[model samples]
Every structure is written in structure tokens, then in C-alpha cells.
Target chain A: MAAEHADSGFNIFPMDQFVIRPLFGNHGMTWYTPTNQALWMGIAIVAVVLLLVIGTRGRALVPSRTQSIAEVFYGFTYKMIEDINGKAGLKYFPVIMTLFTFVVFANILGLLPYSFTVTSQAAVTVFLALAVFLSVTIIGLVKNGPGFLKVFWISSAPLPLRPILAIIEVISYFVRPVSHSIRLMGNMMAGHAVIMVFAGFAGALGIFAVFPVVAIMAVYGLEVIVAFIQAYVFAILTVIYMNDALHPGGH
Target chain B: MASEQLMAGAGQIGEHAEGMPQLDFANYPNQWFWLVVTLLVLYVVISRIALPRIASVLAERQGAIARDIEQAETLKRQAVEAEEAYKKALADARAEAGRIVAEAKADIQKELDIATEAAEAEIAAKSNESELRIAEIRKGALDSIEAVARDTAGEIVKAIMPVAADQKAIDAAVTAKLKG
Candidate 1:
């Protein structure tokens, strides 16, 4: 028992779980190294394939269970995009669906013991957010030309305050990806860390360890819900941002 | 021991900051590459294969249901038309039956009227023949009585005066007496 250590081994390395390491022999990490992140991501990809691709192979009018699960995800993503962005935004449906399924699968798979959470990393989330941001900006530019700048102009505001509001709008516009990415990463990382911290208490508590174990169970359940919600939030935010790109003059 | 070595390795990797591995910038490229590859695969599977297949299945189902409903409606209309034809045939048959029955009744009535008239005429002729035969029988009976009376009177006169009576006078007396 690690509890035999001096001062009752209270070594609770919550962040250690987030540490990236090579999946095979520990070698220096390069750009193309196969890491645990890649393994779990691969697993997430397999999950998506099993659910969306092979699951719907039946193509039944009356769907089977796995097919229904795939349809639920599809319907949920479709409704989210259509509700926020309307018909024009459906062109970007694939991107949003990918984002949703990736985040959801990654987050949920992270809940497994000893499994690495891919979405918890700032690098991955930041890239996703930046992808949405850059694409939406380019789409706005291409679609609206100079008219896309009107998103920040706030024509409804009084003339004198319009410039200040525009400045704020522009800053917030750039800040969107930062908030978007951090929100998902922070939620995943924080929940998992909290569960780890709680599990760490079981070592020293002995008989009272039941409390921490129970708390871990409770937090694990909450994390499961948080995992789905964070993905939904990410996908919906992407749709909303895309709506701004599609109809920049509306805001 | 593994935890310690893992911590040591992690620590060695980030000599300056052991706080959060997420901030470690060296691993960013590895994460980015795999993520992009995975997303590309998912996007291809979803947009290219899954979504369109589901949409077509749903559309096919919709079309099938519409076609079934239309077929049912057509069948129902045909049934209605058949029923109408049946009813019209029944009504026409009933009317034809009624016409036949009326014609038969008229024919029977004319036959009955002709029979009744022939019976009445035969009865009238039979009654006239019977009256003529009764008048002839009465005349024969009157002649027989007159002859008998004349013979009896002549027999009485011969017994009293031995005189013979005339037949013509007897007959004239008898006829005058019968008339009175």
C-alpha cells in the first residue's frame, strides 16, 4: 500500500493523468510520434465509424438500436445547426457533425479508467476552435465581401457609441475561439482532475475511504453529463458563429 | 515505482513547469496531426456515406407511403364505382321485374274479362232455349187435354141420345174456355 509512505502517502498527482506520453517505447516526442493521445483518438474514430458508418449499414426504415443511436446523434447535430444557422448553414454540416462526434467520443472515452482524454488538451481544442474561427471568417469574407465587417459595426447603436461598440465587437469576435476552446478543455480537464483528487483521498482515509469513493462515483456521473453538454455547447457555438458568417449583417 | 518514474520522466520533459502538461508545447504537433486526420476520416464517412444513405432511405419510405395511400384511394374509388354499378343493376332489374309483373297482370285481366263475357253470353242463350222449350211443352199439354175432354163428352152424349159430337166444335169450346 502506498499509504505506508512517510506521513501517509498522500501523493495525488491529478495533472499527471493529463501528461502526454508515447504509446509504444518511451522515446522523444516528435510531430509524428504515436502517443496515447493518438491511440485514444484512434479509438474515438473507431467508435464513430462503428456508430455512424457500419451501424447504419442496414439502412432500415425502422432502425436498429445502433442505427437509432447514430440517427439520434445525426438528428441532434442537424437540428442544432439548422436551429442556430438555418438553411444556409447546412453546407457546413459535416464540419459541425465531426466536431460534435469527436468531442463527445473523446470526452466519454476519457471517462474509462487509464484512458487518455484527447479533448482535454489545449492543443487539440485550440486547433478545432481556430479551424471554426478561420473558416467562418473566410466564409464571411468570401460571401459578404466587405459587408462582413458590418458584424462589428452595430448599425443599430447610436453613431458616437457605434465605434466603441465596434471596437468591443471586434475584440470579442477574435476572443470567440479562445473562449470556445478553453471552455471545452477546461470543463473536461477540471472534472477529471476533481475525480482524481477525490480518488486520491481514499489512500489515507482507510475505513473512511468509502466517502471519497462514493464522491468519485458521483463526480463521475456528473462528468458523463458534462461530457455530452460540453460537446453540445461546442457544436452549437460553432453553428452560431457560422450564422454570423452567413448573415453578418444580422448582428 | 512506475508512477515515480512517470512523474520523473514528465518532470524531465518539462524542467521549468511541472504544473500542467497541457501547456507543454512540444506535444502540440502530434496532437494536431492525429486530430486533423481523425476529423478528415469522420467527415468523409459522415458527409459522403452515412448522411446521404439515411436521407435516401427516409425519402424512399416517404414515397412508398404516399404511393400506398394513393393506391388505396384508387381501390376505394373503384369499389365505390362497382357498388354504384351493382346498385344501378339491381334497380334496373327491379324496375324490369315490376314491368313484367304488371304486363302479366294486364294480360291475365284481359283473359279473365273475355272469359266472363263469354260465360255471360252462353248463359243468356241457354236461358232463351229453355224458355222456348217450356212454351212448346205447355202447348202440347193443352192439346192433349182438349182431345181427352172432347172424347169424354162424345161418349156421354152417345149414352144419353146416341148422338155423335163434332171434333171442331169441341176444340173451339175448349180453346174459348181455356182463354177465359
Candidate 2:
């Protein structure tokens, strides 16, 4: 990244923004100390509340602008939950909805000029992915009892290879959270960092900054799509995991 | 700003990536603390406030649309029913009018028959009276002609035979000639 910026002599500090710092001032680290991550995450929650709760306060049959937007998002998530996991899956809709709303808002707010992306940290995303993973596993175990293990035992495979495949399935199942967390964190961080690098270039390029600015706009557009897509992917994957727990299948 | 930071050491690239802050385990505790706090808040807001509100709005709209459609269907049904009633009434009225017209035609025919019978009777009575009056006139004219014949015969006899003929004979002869 620096080699490309050599002509402009611009050294971008894109990753520095991800650092969790004390919200009050430069102070020694403590768990109780409110950090920038907390501040932004709090803002993300407020943003969601504003969009959904306050936005649809009227509950008009003929929806207003904010009401329509809220209703559209609500209907989308509702349909997604109903279709992906079935009506029985709606029992866990609140958790899934909370996660989706958080991720979406975090990504969108992160795109704002100089706003911190809460989801960009592995610390945040990993916790969310782990929560989903643990919940689905527990639910599967609780609901299916010993039958939950049937998901790993592939009866269709040859007896000799069945155990090997089961081992692979267990490993892959455990690896889900790692991939889930990393995917969102990496995507969010990469998009923002790339934009920051381009913006850094535009800073030193003087009148010729139009090219980098255009690239930034294009990447920004792509990142917007990525943000929504990542949220959808995370939520849908959660539904799939729940489905597995609800009905453990083999091969 | 990065160049000044880079002057500190060649290995330290800049504040940008001089240290991978995302992997900084020291900051993880505080980040996790906030993550949990904010997540709780978001969950409360979404499940308690946002989700229900938005769900209700969507449901309300759906219900309104369904009600409107049902109302329109009912109205359509009513219109169809009204049209059926109108058609039935029109058919009934047409049948009644046809019956009335038939009855009126029968009544007019009866009145015409009665008037024709009365007029025919009056004409027949008047004809009978006129026939009687003609017979009487004919009888009167015959009597006058007989009287004149008798008188003329008597005079001719008196003049030719120089004697008066018998009255009874003259009358009988006139009567016979007239009958022949």
C-alpha cells in the first residue's frame, strides 16, 4: 500500500482506527473504561431504534417515508426468517433479528465519514458468531437429544470412510464461527481501509485527486452492497444452523 | 502525521500499520465489555421496541389492504344482487303489462259487441215500422183507385146505355180487375 503511495508521499493509517481507545481521554486500559467501540456500538443501537421504533411510531396503514422503510426492512427479515427456518424457527427470530440489525447498522454507520465500525473488530464479530454457534448447538442438543450426533454420522458413506467423514464434519462444524466472524470483520475492515488508502492518496495528489476520488466512490458503492450482503449472510447462516439443530440429518 | 511517526523507527511503518491494533489483546477486554453492553441495549431496543413496532405497522397495512379488498368484493356482490333484482322486477312488470293489455283488448271487444247488438236491434225495429207504413199507404191508394173506377164506369154506362149501373157490381168489377 505504501509503495503505491510513494509518488504522493502519503502514508495512510487505516487500521489505526480499529484500535479500542478510552472514550474519556488517553487513559490506562480497564474493562470498566468506556471505549470508542462501546460508543460506536451504542450509537449503532440508537440508530436501529431510531429507524425501526421511532420511525414507525405512527403505524399508519398507508405508511409514511420512515414507516415504509421500517416496514420494508421488517417484512424482509420476517420473510427471511419464515422461509429459511420455517415458522417454528421464528422462536429464535429476536436473536437473529438483533444480530442482523446490529451488523447492518454497524456496517452502515462505519461507512459514515470518520465513524468507527464496531463489526470490523474480531472481538465483536467473534463474540456474535460464537453466540450463534453456541446457541444453535445447545438448541440442537436439547431438542434432538442424542439424535443431534446423527448430523455427523453419514450413513450413506462406506463404513470405513464414514468415521473419517464424521471427523471432517465435526471439525468443519467447529470452524464455522471462525469463518463467520473473520468473513464479516475482514470484509468491513478491508473496504474501509481501502477507501482510507485511496483518500490518503487523494490528499497528496493535489488537483489530480479526481481519479482516486472516483475510485473511492466506486469502492464505496460496492462496500454498501457488501455491508447489506454480509448482514444477510450472517443471519441466513444462523437460520441454517438452527435448522440443522432442529432436524439433524446425515450425508 | 505518519511520516513523523515513521521517524521514530524504520521498522515502525507508521500509525497506520506500525502495530496491528485489531490483534491487540490488551484492548480486547474493554472492547468485549462495550460489545456486550451495546449488544444488550440493541437487543432490548430491537426485540422490545423496534421489532414489535415495525411488525405491527406492517401487519396493520396488510390488514387494511385485506379489509379494503373484502369490502370491494362485498360491494361487487351487492351490485350484482341489485342488478339481478332490477332484472327480475323488469320481467315481472313486463308480464303484468302484457296481461293488462290482453284484458283491455277483451273489454273493448265486449263493449263493441254490445254497441253493435243495440244498433242492429234499433235498425230492425225501425225497418218493421217503415214496412207497415208502406202497406197501409198501398191499401189507401187501391181504395181510391177503386172508387174512381166505379164512378167512371157508372157515368160511361149511363151515357151509353142511358141507365145507371149497379154500385155493388161496379165495386166488385174494380176489385177483380185490381186483383188480376
Candidate 3:
């Protein structure tokens, strides 16, 4: 492992030191772990809770500026849910809002001087993505009963092509969570690593630092915009999934 | 020999590093546990708290707009009624002025007719009295002239003939002169 670490140009990939290695060996265990990512997750949860608890406690009619901003976020999420799922979708507004806020905060927080980005780790993003996937699948099954299989194959095409298309459709459906998780993790990990390398260059080339510094600044600005966009993309996907579960007309 | 083995191992590692990570669901054991917890918490919060508040706020905003429109309609109706009342009052006032002017003109005409009739009666009475007074003056003058002529004739007869101065004869001559 040490030789592998040395072989890499830099130690950018997470290692066992960054994870909480399980005390005992079990049937399922990994050589790699993500302890820093777990810690960041805890921080994200606390921050989200603190913001929500304080923001919603008073429930004022004529909102203060702070309260009004909170209201706007809540309103935006509600409208998104309504547009995607109609009135029935309103029930999922809080989850979508929380997910959006947490992911965005996690992304932006990683841009801070000494902060670790939890979302950059595959495990963290995979966990969130899988949860959405399972819930949507379960909702579809519960709502449609045996008819849920029609979402994949039986409802669309002729009988001869149904089996062939069903297999492909099923594989794609299973791949949704993997793609969703990897997309976010890969983006965050790549962006952070690039910024780190640029900052390192600025540190190394002390006298002629202007180019590196400007590059870092530009990357930072782009990261901030990406942070917001990733959150929106995640939330919008969740709404689309909910829509699929509710009304499976290939939307 | 050890140096050669190490170099070969390094080459193999470099080659393996380029390949993507294997799909190892077993290695990622905590995935299921975290997924369950996150989903449960999110579902509970969404169903219980967040959605209801948002819906109620939207409903309230819609209600307020409807109420404002209703109030505006009522106010417009009241304004129209007030305008109609003002126009009606102005029309009544104009009609009253016209009636009063016509009545005054009729009263002045009646008074002028009565005054003209009274002046004409007074002038007719004064003219009749003047005519009666003139007739009396003329009769008196005639009587005085007749008496003077008779006295002059009697004096002339007495101077001419003493015998003729008898009372019966002088009386007969005077009577004849007066007659002629």
C-alpha cells in the first residue's frame, strides 16, 4: 500500500487513514475507508438542522429578511415538487429541500481553506443516491402492485420485442443510482483535486505566483457555480424519480 | 534477483492502476445502513412538517387576492350611486328656479292691470264735475245781462214822455224789448 501511494504522482486518492477501519474482520470488508467523509457528513447534518430549526421556529406572517429568504427556498422547492408531481408530489417537498441544501452546503463548504468535501467520496454520494432509488422503486411497487413491471416493458411495445427491451430497460434502471452517485462524486473529487494542484503550484512558484493565483481564483468561482448547479440537478432528478413512481408514462 | 522482482511488480501495479475500480458491493458495506437512515429521516420530516405549511401559505395568498377584487367591485358600485344622486339633485334645483321665475312674472302682470283701471276711473269723475260747473256759470251770466238791459230801457222812456212813464205801459215796452 505504501509502495502504491509513492507510485502515484500525488496522494490525492483517499486511503485507509481517511476512513474508520472496522475493528474486526467480517464477511464483507473493504481495504479502503472514508473516516473524513463521515465526519464531514456529521457537520453537514448539524448545519442543516441548525438552519432549519432556527429559520422555521417563529413562523411569522410578515417575515424578516432572513425568514423571507428561508421562505423563498421553501417556496422554490414546493413549486418544483408541484410541477413535477402535481399536488400529490407536495408531500416530498421537505426531503427535496433538505437534500438540495445539504448537498450544496457540502460542496461549498469543501471550498473553504481546510475543509474536506464529503460528497467527493464515492461512498457518501452512493449512499444518498441509492436511498432515492430504493424509495422510488418501493413507491412504484406499492402504488402499482404487480403492474409496476409495466414501467419497464409490458406497457410500451409489441410482445416479441418486449422481453428484449425489458432486459435492457431493467439494466438501465439499475444503473440509475450508480450513474447519479458517480457523477456528483467524480465532479467534486476532480474539481477539488485540480484546485489543490493549482494552489500547490502557487506555493511552489513563490516569485512568479500571479498565474497560479489567478487560475485558482477562477477555479474557485467556477466551483461555486458548480456547487449550486449540482444541488439543483440532484433535487430535480429526485423530483423526476418521484414523478416516475407516481405516473410511469415514460416521463 | 530482489531488485528485478521489485521492478516487475512496479510495472504490473502501473498497468493495473489505469483500470477502473471493480464493482464491489461487498467492499461498500455501509451503503445500505446509511441509505435506510437518510431516507427514513427525510420521509418523516417531509410528510409531517414541511409540505403542510407551504400549501397553507399558498392558499392564503390566493384568498387575499380574491378578497381585494371583491372589495374593489363594491367600492365602484358605491361611487356610481353617489354620482347618480348628485346629478338628480342638480336637475331638481334647476326645475325649482324656473317655476319661481314664471310665478313672479304672473304676479307683476296682475298688479299692473289693477293700477291702470283705478287711474282711468278717477279721471272720468273729475271731467264730469268740470262740465256741470261750466253750465252753471253760463246760466248766471245770461240772467245778469237781461236785468241790466231792462233797467236802461225804462230810464230812456221816462225821459222822453212823462205820460209814457205809467207803470203798465213801461212794463209792456220792456217786455217787448226783451222778447225781441
Candidate 4:
């Protein structure tokens, strides 16, 4: 029965469906289906909300297990903010923590079998990175006026070299969001693709599938760890970006 | 050939010409719809109800730590005061002991002085009494000697010479002998 089905070219696990396709014409880059990505995003959001509600609803001085876990996450983010930007950074706690929790849950959810990895798509990661970039830039400008431009220029070198170095600095500064978004998207996409390839191998190898199956299992576990690490890396980079915006100087 | 075969196998498994059930955001699965609804509810609850309570609890914890530190300071001060009082009491006890020892020594010295004075006075009074008795005995012995001498001379005169016993003679003889 399996040979008959195989001869008919009927694949049990569809891999091509994950491919990006163009939505429209003319400068319309190929992108993942928004529907699938949005569904995953919705799931991630719900997970975060459930965690917050349950964790915060019954807070005791000596916390419940859930509350303690939530507090640890909260404390970790709080410390990260404080360490990166000092006491003044506390004002951005809500946004930073929200972003951290959202991204982390989304990445972790992707590791589940049959779940869509929304963070694997460039569009979603780009949107997040661009949002962070625009907000930090605007905040810097608002806080420091036209002087915020000095963040890419005057802070790096002596006055005589400012004009020449400013061009290079500004170019690099603009590249920040691209690199940030691509880093997360690339890691997640590569990890998921590798896992899919391994899973497919297990199916293709038939009776001699023990090695492939073990390898796929090991890769799946690693993907779970990678998901969390990618989220943390994204959040940490966001903090560093915000710090540069706020400080303007290296100090 | 194998790739084509795999694609065919996948298509047969999927069955639907368009492939695995494509997600439609407009008409999401019931599970996802309910998940969104639950998430919206939770977001409201967290922003409105949960976050404020957590903030207050954190504030309370900070206040508790401050209170504990202040209470510890107060207890430390009280301990210092108690220690000072204890030291003062110990010092007073030592001083009192010294005073008691001094007083005892003085009392002993005073008793010793009085005893010495009383002993000296008794010795002087005994010496005076002994001297007075010696003088009286000496005077009595002298008088007795004179009386005996007078009686012996009178008898001597009566035996040796037949002379009448006259008061003038006897008195002259006693007087001459006493003088000699």
C-alpha cells in the first residue's frame, strides 16, 4: 500500500507549502502567507496573556510556583533594562518586557510539532525591528533635539574627523535594523528548515530510519534551545539600540 | 525521479488540490478565534487588574525591607543603651566594693587606735597605783622603826640604870636617837 501511494507521487509530509510566494506584482517581494503567520502570532499573544493573568492574579510575598516563574522573568528583564540603560531605562520597562515575552513565546511556540514558526518569516521580524528602530530614533530626537544626530557622528571621533566619520557612522547606523531582523529570521528559519529536512529523511529512509529519527529528535531539542536564545538575542540587541539612542555618547 | 515521486506522495497525502488546509485569517479556526478572544480578555485583565496589584506588591516589599532595616537600627540602639547601663552598673558595683573595703579598713584602724589608747591608760593607772602603794609602805615602815627604837631604848635605860622614868628624859632620849 505504501509503495502504491509512493508510486502515485503522494507525499505524506508536504514541505513546499512553507515556501514564500508573491502576493502581488511590481516590487511585491515574495512573502509568507499572512494568514498562517497571523494565526501563529495570535497564538503567541494568547499564551503571553494567559501567563500574565495567571501569574499576576494571585501574587503572594512568597510567590506561588507560577508567580515565581513570572517574577523571575520580570526580574530578569528589569535587570537587563537597568543594566543596559541605568535607572532612567526603567521608564521603558513595559515595552521591553512586553516585547521580550511576546517574542520568546512566539519562538517557543514554533518549536511545537505542526505549529507555524511566525518568527521564521522576514516580514514579521522586519516589522518588529523597524518598529524598535523608528521608536528609538524618534525618542532620541525628541529627548535630545537635533543633537541626537550626534549619536552617529560626534560621539565617535575628534572634531576634525567628524564630517568624514559621520558618513560611515550614519550608514552603519541605518544598517542596524536590517541586521537585527535578519539575524532572528535567519536563525529561526535555518533551524526549522533543518528540522524539517531531518524529519523528512526519517520518512524517506523507511526501514533504515533509526539514525535519521534519532538525529531529528536531537535537532528538535536543539531547536527548542535555539528558539529561546534567538529571542534573548533579539531583546538584548533592542536594549543596546535603545541605550545608544538614550545616551548618544559612548559613556 | 525520487523528488517527483516524493512530491506525488505528498500531494496524495494532502488530497486537496490547494494542499494542506490553508489558514484564512478572516475565517480562522474556532480554536484560534477563541484563543484571540481569550487573549484580548487577558490583556485587559492584566493591564487593568493584574499589573497594578503587582506594582503595589513590589512597593510593599520595598517598604517591608525599609521597615525591617529601621527596626533593626532601633533594636541596635536599645541594645547599646542596655550595654551602657550594664557597664555603668558594673562600674558602680566596683566603686561600691572599693568604698566598702575602705570603710572596713578605717573602722579596723579606729578600733585599733582606741584599743592602743585604752591599753596605755590602763598601764599608766597601774603604775601610779603601784607607786602610791610603795610610798605608803615606806612611810609606815619608817614610823614603825621609830616606835620600836623608842621602846627598845626605854627598856635599855630601865635595866642598866636605876633612874626614874620621866617623860622629859624619855622624850629627850628618843628625840636624840631619832635625830641621829
TM-score chain B for all models.
Answer: 0.62, 0.55, 0.46, 0.47
For lDDT, candidate 1 versus 3, the one ahead is: 1
Local distance difference test, each candidate? 0.86, 0.82, 0.67, 0.71
lDDT of 3 by residue, B1-180 (tens): 644533442343322222222122233455345434544564455446644554465466667778989999999999999999999999999999999998999899889889888888888888888888888888888777666666666677777876677756666676777778
Write one digit per residue (lDDT tens) for candidate 4, span A9-65: 434443343432222322222123234455666787667766666676776776778
DockQ of predictions, in order shown: 0.31, 0.33, 0.10, 0.10
Q: What TM-score does candidate 1 get on C-alpha atoms?
A: 0.74
What residue pairs clash in candidate 3, if any at all? A18-A35, A19-A35
Candidate 3 vs candidate 4: which has greater TM-score? Answer: 4
Residue A223 local lDDT, model 4: 83
Model 1: per-residue Cα lDDT over B1-180, one tens digit each? 644544454444432224788877766777899888888888898889888876776677789889999999999999999999999999999999999999999999999999999999999999999999999999999888877776776666657766546656656766777678
Candidate achieving higher lDDT, 2 or 4 = 2
- Candidate 4 chain A TM is 0.84
**Candidate 2 wrongly placed segments (more than 4 Å):** A1-8, A154-168, B1-16, B113-180
Task: Report the lDDT tens digits of candidate 4 across residue range B1-180.
Answer: 644533443343323223322222222233233334434554465456555666776777788889999999999999999999999999999999999999999999999999999999999999999999999999999989878887777777777774765646876789787888
Output the worst ten-in-a-row residue range by lDDT, candidate 4 chain A: A22-31
lDDT of 2 by residue, B91-111 (tens): 999999999999999999999
Can you tell me the DockQ of model 4? 0.10
Per-residue lDDT over A1-251 for candidate 2, one digit per residue giving the tens place of the 0 to 100 score: 55664655786767767766667755465667877778888889888888888888887778789878877777777788888778888887787888888899999998989788888988888989999899989988999899999889888888999899999999999999999999999999999989988988888889999999999999999999999999889888888887888778823
DockQ class, candidate 3 = incorrect
Docking class of 2: acceptable
What ranking emerges by TM-score with the best candidate at the front? 2, 1, 4, 3
